[model samples]
Target: MHYVKSKSILSAKNGMNLYRGCTHGCIYCDSRSKIYNMNHEFEDVEVKENALELLKKELIKRPKAMIGTGAMTDPYIPAEKHLKFVRNSLELIYRYGFGFTCITKSDLVLRDLDLLEKINEKSKVVVQMTLTTADDELCSILEPNVCPTSRRFEVLKMLDEAGIATVVWLCPILPYINDTEENINSILDYCIEANVHGVLCFGMGLTLRDGNREYFYEKLDEHFPGLKARYIKEFGNDYSIPSHDEKRLMEIFKYRTSKAGILNDTNEIMSYLSEFPQKSVQSKLF
Candidate 1:
């Protein structure tokens, strides 16, 4: 882990990434894409040393709106356990009466359940977790360092019980590996059981850019021999790699989420994430 002072903390849309790199070791991380221009090694986590002070300043100036994190990097990475950056930032957001939302693949989020509940009471808190595969064994291979999908499902249920809204990012569906109907159904079952507010899936396949494509193919060679060659043959320098079963699996995704009454529309879910409870702002004003 290393530290660097960032010029700014929050994006135009109020998103803040406390860290620059990652360590969860997910095989298909798009953050590794060359466009982000991450100068350090992907696993070498970069800490924004002045993020908290900067966040507090920005929050004070801005109107009540949802502050998002973990868009480029998961805020709950192992470093958070000791650094307490995420937990501290949550306290700041709560202190300033601002809303909070984050996307993560770790159960370490459970540690700050109290802050999340507190923020929800003041404004709103939406926690989004990525669940790619239903099988814990497959999850271990795909995600590697973090907790499995089953544990993430448990976290979602706990968040729901606390009355905090939750969303699931069911994505990066590897072509032949996890693009099966059964995998989609099993993951959707977990979402329904957890009572998530929505499930966001852009398509049935992962996007591979220059940097990530090389890394993903390397991992494929390590685990699934000859799979890299297969991917190269099937998708030659293509950015969007759609699965052969995209249509069928999407049908299952829509049917299951619709039956469960979960939000399936990406636009609606994003609006929900960015929307602040006006009542919370009004309460603070008066």
Candidate 2:
């Protein structure tokens, strides 16, 4: 890991990525796409040395809104155990009375439950997690470096018990791999059991682009041998590689999430993530 001074931490939309690059070795990572233009190896995480400082400055100057992280890199990556940037950023967010939201697959998020609860008590805190495959063994193969879906389910339950809201990103279901109706229903069951507020699923397939496509194909050859050739034959450099069962699987996804009363629409989930709690506004008024 290397540290670099960052000029600003929050994006125009109030999103923050305290670290760049990732060690999570997920084969379908879109961040690896050349369109992002990272200068270093994906695993050589780039730490924004001044992220917390910049966050404090930005929070002070900007109007209160939900401050999000983990879009570009999971803020709770293993590096967080020592660096503690994500934890410190939460402290700052709580101190300044801003709502907080983050997308992560790590169970390490439970470590900061105190801060999340505090923030939710004052404003809002939404914990969004990604669950692609329900089977532990398959989960290990797909998201090798992170906690399995089972543990993430526990994290969601924990967040619910703490009175913090939660969302799930049920996505990037590899076409011939984890795109089965059983996998989708299993993950939705976990969401239902955990009482997640929403499940964000764009579709039942993954996207492949230049940099990520090469990496994904390499891993496919290593793990699922001969699958790479099939992908080439079938997809042939297409960006959106929808599953053969995408239509049927999406029906199951929508039906399950709708029955559970979980927000399944992407727009609704994004709006929920961005909305600041009215309680925070009232507190400011008083």
Candidate 3:
């Protein structure tokens, strides 16, 4: 891990990543793709030393606060164990009494549960977790070296039981990998049982680009020989890689989430996520 000054902290949409690379080593990470132009090794991890200071300034000056992170890289990577950068940012967010949201697969986030609960209590905080496959063995192969699917499910359950509203990213279900109806149904079943607030599904598939496409294809060759060739022939530089059974799977996804009252539309999910602040607290008080 190395520290460098950042020009800016938050994006126009109010998102910020304190780190630039991930250590989770997920074989299919799109952040590793060349389109991102990350100059360092995918695992080298560039730390934004001044990000906290910048964020503090932004938070103080902004008219409203709804900070999000973990888009380009996972905030709670192994490097986070020592850097504490994310923790520092969280402290700042809470100090300012700002709403917070994070997308991560690491159970390390549980370490910040106390702070998260406090943020949720004082303002708003949402934790988003991605669940691709319910099968543990398959999970290890696709998202190897991170917490298993069961552990992630437990995280969702724990968060829900704590009254911490949660959203599940039921996405990137790789074709010929985990796109089966059974896999999708099992994950959706768990999401429903966990009583999550919403589930985001983008038509039951993954995206591949210059860097990410090559990496994903290589992994495909390593794990499922001939599958990479299939993808190459079907998707030729195209970004969207929908499953062959996408229509049926999407139907199930929509039906199951709708029945559970979980938000499923991408626009609706983003609208809900990007919502600046909820008036529920003030309304409840009134």
Identify the candidate with maximal lDDT. Answer: 1
lDDT of 1 at 95: 97
lDDT of 2 by residue, 1-286 (tens): 9999989999999999999999888889999999999999999999999988899889999998999998989889999999999999999999999999999989999999999999998889999999999999988888899999999999999999999999999988998899897888899999999999999999989999989999999999889999999999999999999999989999998888898899999998899899997752334554
| Candidates arranged by lDDT, highest first | 1, 2, 3
Better candidate number, 1 or 3, judged by lDDT: 1
TM-scores of the candidates are 0.97, 0.97, 0.95
Q: Rate the local accuracy (lDDT) of all candidates.
A: 0.94, 0.92, 0.86
For candidate 1, the clash count comes to 0
lDDT of 1 by residue, 148-233 (tens): 99899999999999999999999989999999999999999999999999999999999999899999999999999999999999
Candidate 2: regions farther than 4 A off: 280-286
Query: Per-residue lDDT of 14-61 in model 3, one digit per residue for the tens?
Result: 999899988776767889888888888877889888988899999998
RMSD of each: 2.1, 2.0, 2.4
Q: Which stretches of candidate 1 lie above 4 Å from their native place? A: 280-286
